[model samples]
Target chain A: MNAFRAVAVAMLLLGMQGGGVPAVAAPANAVDKPVRIDIRNFAFAPATLTVPAGTRVVWTNRDDEPHLITSAGKQFDASRALDTGDTYAVTFAKPGTYAYYCSIHPMMVGTIIVQ
Target chain B: MRDANDSTNERRRHFLGCMAWAGAGTLWLMKGGVLQAQPLGGADAASAADASFSFVQISDSHIGFHKEPNPDVAATLRASLNMINAQSTRPDFLLHTGDLTHLSRPEEFDTLGQLMSEARSGKVFYVPGEHDVIGDNGAEFFRRFGERQQAGGWYSFDHRGVHLVGLINVLNLQAGGLGSLGAEQLAWLKNDLAGRSADTPLVVFAHMPLWPLYPPWGWGTDDSAEAMSYLRRFGSVSVLNGHIHQIQQKVEGNITFYTARSTAYPQPAPGQAPAPGPLKEVPPGSLHRYLGIRDVRHVQGRQALAVTEEVLS
Candidate 1:
């Protein structure tokens, strides 16, 4: 009887551990942060921004003319003209400061500070 | 000595030629002026006013447009400016009703700034069009022209006994392409006009049509009626807007709504095209004739605006 009770307690512990596994694992994969950048009138919204590493930043064009989101040193080029309501996103896997501007309108400059 | 008579004969011939040319010129002048008279409406009234305080209304000067309808917008603007400068009564100032630049690029803005500075009228008042605030993060326009303006480029001032109100409706343009006036600005406008009596002549200038010019093109403001409600108490109200690139006028009660032509290109009339864009190429020189400026004059407590569309042929 003693041995059987001990086995039953072990089974209860396994069930609790199984339930906690999902809870712990769920948090690791559940959080997603997306940053939005707006393009209008030849300028960028939040001309300056800060985001955590691995955050996805989306750019949407709201102006009539075509625009581009290209990194300052030509590291990444979203060369296509993003139409109105169209979005372009880039995930910052590595932490760094990225300065960008619309290639079509160079005067439209913005900075994304990633930490 | 024998050729003296020949020289006299030559001089006589020259005299006769001049006489003939003068006769032809007189006939040509009669025909030309007669043709112009047919379309010259309100000429008698205009001529009666010996002293007129007239100002120029330039709307939708969408610079940076490289389309066929208005292949050379800057040139057309220059032509319009020249025409305005050459008018018999030089306008006191210029009122630009928005969409100053096509995409609001700094270069485009810079270019527009340079061109406007060159205008004969040193004073130019502006409001924002939906296009002007794209990606500006809400302050690009103010940084350039908001030194004296209130609330993101909306302001009021008195000019020649006329109360001019410039409103900002293009910020955060709605999804349906409607212009919105935030609660703060609307309240400010209401308070701004609260003290004024009914006799005060008010002129409201915005980028989008304050009335329903056309909804499909997103030409009209969404909350324009609310804005108009504030103006109903005024005896004389004139609301002018751009963004449609055509001339349309409506009179509701004591209020008059006028949409000015774009100095850049012509868009199709409402319901005339599938979508709003640069119209097809009209023959060269047709655009300037179609697009120009409006001249507004206030006389004897009456406000009359004469639109002179000059095609740059």
Candidate 2:
């Protein structure tokens, strides 16, 4: 999951400043590091999140049961059933409010807002 | 050597402890539901091996799934087919309750198709579980296996005086993720059963439990009571389902409701764990004990249906 966040941040940095790998943190701190979403008790912790554009979020399954991270819209592929200890990462590139649920257990729902 | 065996025994004890905590009185329901004054389980009646016709029932294949508990679902499914093939009298057909694929991926369907092709049964019938319809209202699944069902992916067929109906209750999941068979399916079921003789033997198959096995985990269907109401008049009724991934049986009146174990993996018994997914970290070689197939034999003259299970291992 951290590697995915690093790659996502790397892409954002490459797009911001051409021809350079900047070691120093700047505006990247907020958008680069991921926000954690823990899936436990058949729900997404902090069922909602508001992060800046280019921000990446990582959902880790902490429950004994399997869960999924699926966007309600066609924004992303519904995640495969995630066994305990499995992690799924999704990055919000554009600015918009996206809603999602565990397709397996439709009762579960969460939201992500990017600005 | 004694030390290793001792640790294994401890682990089994721990697992059984967790199971008992999850299921208290309900554990007895596994076999005792037949005595609940609804249907005659007829469990006491000796199940006759000889039958004029028979069919095999399997559920929750969950192909394309790669996770703990059972990573090689295809292989387990093959194991099931091997059992089917080895049956001395080849079953006239096979009934797949639902959840054919995990994420409903094309490759999963491809794999399920290939493994099923190896079955010695005459034909395989399917009813969609919620997982099978995950992405696009089951268009992909229907496109591949939906031709025979007249409409709504639910159909009824007849074999040797037995009327079999396959219903779809997972199309629209209800509260608590309970399976639902919309009005259309219920009306069709009502009309479908019309005019049939009361003595005609009946077998109904669906993806979710038609009777509310456990509501908290969506183990039961919402409006199946109405659907089941249509069949009370029949002399014999057997409702088969999957999705719980464990065997639980109930007999209410002439209606017998049974849920099959999954070939993929076992889930915590209903309401056992926080929520139902897969039960993992089982003792070695114990997984097969939780997986198996149900074979139904229909003899021309018999008070009790020969409904029996054979474990995958």
Candidate 3:
């Protein structure tokens, strides 16, 4: 898997250089299986996510501060305030885009797309 | 060997004694309806004695927090209460701006309550920090420390002739936004201040800073500008806030905005760190210098209140 990823990234870089594309790098996190979202340093890692419709997405709080998972559009039931090392999981069955944020620290936001 | 150990112990005690009295607390003199600031210690007794009443402000106790910079937050909070109890000028009340607990746990609130009960002040006012309202939207906080049965956890009252307002801005917060005082609370504030005279001195306390000190980190409030509009008519307005975990002051016209330091831990200065949270890099034994409390003095006839900030060290 590592070798495949390295080759794929190299080929993509070469393609970008040859095609004179913008200096954008490939997506760092592309998960096809169950995914874990880390809440750290007052942020959600992989802030923008894309996953399969049946994938179950899990969010774990890593910072000492607590975070409450709230959907901006009410797409999902809100999670209880997650303390350090606590987690909340939700399965994305519908293929759509959803937005969510930490209700406690509203400044922290994330987005997920299920396809 | 014994003599060497004794000398070291004596030096350590001397160092701690010096730390306790190291920082200077401010003495706010209310004269002719305006407040002026001076050093607190050794101020003329005649002036301080003439003050009508005094109150204390302690914030961000974060009782459940057990981490670097300070492990035992309860101990520090107890120390803070001790200082207030030992005040030469007994404070009439105590205001805990917010962040009374680290994660809003039941035991955390219980510990805070037990510790604050020892304060010599007559009353302790409270507002909810983001940390205090977790999980239940402040149901536990309201049940424990709320002053009124109001829905928004915001209320006001008269203390020593000064109009004090405790506003809750940590609820219904939106994504990618700063702290918010929703429309309901804003309307309440309008009606609350409607009958007050412009000459009445106003002291507003909230969990987040009312002024936009640093918006990127959510240190300020979103609709605080609107709140300031209602307060503009007042002759003297003092807004106290916690959550930044450090002391910062900004004065605009008649309104003065003050953010108090946390009794639990300190955070980096605005833009000083990559993010805003507990600062974990403090050197040993210096954490107390960044943690402390504020004392405010009010004279009966004056329209302003004097504020004093003292570090725990």
Candidate 4:
């Protein structure tokens, strides 16, 4: 755990430099563990999720068809079209309820609550 | 073949086309914007030998798809083209209603284009399915297949006295809604049909059904009622769509609606299954029975057009 903290600090310092760095990368911490949401049968598994702010959420497409992620209220950037086995990730840095749906199949909807 | 016998042949063809799915091969004849189903291989089939003009409609090719009930979509699409090529009278043009690719991949579209070009059929026209516009808002799709870029892939043309309109209703979709035509396309459609003679026959082709067939399954369009209002002026309006991946028909007053079967795998009927996706539980060697093409014949001075369906098998 101490080594993990050290690496996290190092990444923070590098990210602080700003140029050519992924500054928004999730910090290394237990609370920040990435969450996963699966897309299958044209619906999102765990249609609702609640997590702490700054938690990274990963969406993986497992259905035979393609899906596109779009924020219902334009809360965050929309994802590109995800084909079978393709995955997309978004990090929530603020506390708010985010509702989204598959633009390709708009009837498929899900909600994410970041507290 | 002359105009003298056209009305007599039209009446006979309508009788044969109204047998109501009498056999496995169902034939549809659309008259005055209404459709009647009949059985194929009937003795009266030769009555339509001299249709004024004929075209073929194929939908949901889904070229990149590799799934059960059909693991080889390319083979099925090739089979579809083969069927079209073998028609006794070659089609004057082909209308692909949409979902031409499984995942909107470049190679998927490439495969479809190559195979379609090789067919002896006439010029091919296309409308964007939801799948075709997945990424970059259909930039790739329009670049390759769009005839009118400024019009946003929707265009109208006159063919042998019939006005055919290809519409794009799969873009700018709203969340938690069904297929949409947006305000822009709706305005364009209203103007596209303005001041035209009501006597002109109209054929409107889109990716999804214009009427609200089933809202739960996203099988209908939201603003389609507005679009339909524009079509009500015409005496004969035949609306053709292909997204449900199966054949379905409905008629509203002056408009007749028909959905074509996909060249790819089959999809469950509305609310038949838990949700709408691929149907993988078909018995062995029965997939071809669910895939087919639609043949439409327009006879001049006749209010309705004749539609014949041919399965891949």
Candidate 5:
């Protein structure tokens, strides 16, 4: 839990700097795209993720059921029912901790830390 | 938690009525004090045709849902249409309780419309489910089906001397579970039924169950009791709902409450699973057993509507 708080703090600091350090020192051959979060078996593959600001996270519903990505504070971000093979992408322009869940199934929660 | 819920739902399923899964179906006809399971095609066919009018009910078609126990939901919906088309005496119209589409996508609605175009019934009535209004405040759903209705998208009509009300209870979800029909709709409902005679049979359809079928799973509507208060005087009343993705019926006083099965996929019986979502792990070929629609037949002189559960056999 403390580690999560530390990450949240770091992301907060980075967000203040405006689009924190590049998510990764991209290799010249790497393609620039959003990080993928797969919704399968009613849960996000990586329950929690840390990425740099200006990084886009694309959530793909690979399960047969529909899953949504809604931030804790609905005003932050929310997606349509992400049906099978449907994808929702949002760029984390501001650094902070965004806790989201599939509003349909509140148990399926995930966290994304923007650094 | 799941195990505990499974046991509770198991007991509740037995206590309420026989468990009618997707396959081992049971359609109980209640008369007086006798509750008996009758075949889908029983001797009541002729009687059902003589004095009664029938309307096919298909709910939670969930048109864009492609996953597990049943991946191709369109096939099940097509099967429902086929059943409706093949009805011995054609039903008057179709009533889609709610959850027409999984994600409320335009293409999803397009697919639903494309499939519905082939249905035998020309008229299909719909109310928005939480899934249908996941993101927008039912703007898209209202754009498609909420026509000439009040601002909140609720209206009532009459068919065969029975007053049928389509109520919207999914607009404002409270605390993440259970639907709420604001006071405005309830007032409209009360006013709508004010002038009607007490003998008028009332049928109310919504996406969420009006009665508190199960609060833990968000299966019931919060302010539906107010809506029910208006219809309490009616001699015969039936409430049709979807979203639980299974059929659970209750007969109280003069009213009968029924939740419909989904044409897309089945959810765990109330509290059977950790939460109410699609049920996976069921064998593929047998999915049709759990996915089907309800057929309601109202004999003109009778006080009850003979409800039947016909699966995709």
Candidate 6:
């Protein structure tokens, strides 16, 4: 009985330790970072991008006219007009492919792939 | 006695001819209100038909733009409407070939809507420019004007023996600043034009140049060849686009392509400047002079349409 109890205790401890490892490891995968984007003259500077989940993407309008970062069929929208030198940023929390454009200039488009 | 009467009659006939020529010139100048050069070769041949239906093309209104080049877009748009209203024959409707608002704001759309209401011609047809659909794939524009179209804001209507197609190329833009017609829209376009007879006059309106205008600034459409292929069967194909913000014309096969000037501001000609942006301050009052509207007339049995671009001075 004594040996069995010791074995059971060891098993429980191993299970607990195994469960804690992923709990601690999960956050390492969720490293949140910020990204920068520039909007200018009818095009997005970095036309394509890949970032981790919880990344923040900032877009600066370097053109003389106003611009917006809006996505199709998604809630992501920086609809506020970004004038010359104006800046707008959004932190993407979910992991998926995101395509966005300057609501003002549909031709001005960019994509963000969150993994 | 007979010689005197004959000379008098001859002088009277000559005077009448002179008066008729002056009257025709005056009417032409009035119709060609802005500084746009006269229609290019074959433009008159296209206008030989007396189809009598007229439509207005208003491009690059660049609202919310406040700068030296064109500080007052609203005023220029107003002037464009005034000119449209003043036409000897009012247009059946207005087709705004992209760039309806500079900022794509709710308020900007509202301002544009309000200003456009003053237009004597009712029923405005709109498509997204790269600027107009930047933020939300044109959520605000779609919310307000999308219903006018059927397929993601591209639709077709027939009026007075003419088929008008409003297309969406600004949605998926290419790297060269070329507009795109995506596979879906391309299929739809093929189906749309499939049944129409070759004699049908087809007027295709979009934001970017269907024919190569200037690729460096992203002024042209990358998939325009596919679009043009679908249109090739038609005897009279008129492609009206507006991203260049200047008046330019090109003829390919049976298609006549034209680019309209911006009602708000003027960008430097392709490759003329270091990069494309609202041109730095022009001489005061010169900006509005560049803004104008295009008047297209389709005459029956003619292979071309009379396209006249008049700018606001």
The sequence of per-residue lDDT tens digits that candidate 5 reaches over residues A44-100 is: 879888887777788998876677888876636688776678899988888898888
Write candidate 6's Cα lDDT for A1-115 as tens digits. 2234445665677687775533222233333435788876657779888776777788888888676677754667545777889888888789888887654344566888888
Q: For candidate 5, lDDT tens digit of each residue in B138-195?
A: 8988988775678889999987677889999877554345678888888899999999
- Residue B226 in candidate 4 has what lDDT? 97
Q: Best lDDT goes to which candidate? A: 3
- B163 in model 6: Cα distance from truth in Å? 1.1
3 versus 6: better TM-score goes to: 3
Give the DockQ ranking, best first. 3, 4, 2, 5, 6, 1
Docking class of 5: incorrect
Q: Kindly state the fnat score of candidate 2.
A: 0.31
**Model 6 agreement with the true structure over B1-313: per-residue lDDT tens digits:** 4485674465445433322110000011112111122221112423422425556667888777777656777887787777666665555787788888876778888999898898777588888787777547777888887745564778998876778898998885532246788888888899999998887878888988887787766667778998999988777677888877665677676777777767766666676554566655455655443333223332222334444333222
Give the per-residue lDDT digits (tens) of candidate 1, residues A8-107: 6656776877755322222232115477888764568888887777777899877655566768765555545465567899887777888886543444
The value of fnat for model 5 is 0.24
lDDT of each: 0.62, 0.69, 0.76, 0.74, 0.69, 0.66
Q: Any idea what lDDT model 1 has?
A: 0.62
- The most accurate candidate by DockQ is 3
Q: What's the distance in Å from true for residue B86, model 2?
A: 1.4
Q: Fraction of the real A/B interface contacts present in each candidate?
A: 0.00, 0.31, 0.80, 0.82, 0.24, 0.29
The parts of candidate 2 lying over 4 Å away from their true place are A1-35, A47-100, A109-115, B1-14, B17-50, B174-177, B285-313
Docking class of 6: incorrect
- Clash pairs detected, candidate 2: B38-B252, B38-B253, B39-B251, B39-B252, B39-B253
DockQ, candidate 5, comes to 0.19
- For residue B127, what is the lDDT in candidate 2? 86
lDDT of 4: 0.74
Question: Any runs in candidate 4 off by more than 4 Å, and if so which?
Answer: A1-28, B1-45, B289-313
Candidate 2: chain B TM-score equals 0.79
Residues A15-89 of candidate 2: C-alpha lDDT, one tens digit per residue: 787856655444435567788899887778989898878878999989755567778776876777676799988
Give the candidate number with the greatest TM-score. 3
Task: Please state the interface RMSD for every predicted structure, separated by commas.
Answer: 10.4, 3.6, 1.2, 1.3, 3.7, 4.3
Model 6 residue runs over 4 Å out of place are: A1-59, A67-81, A89-115, B1-51, B147-149, B174-177, B288-313
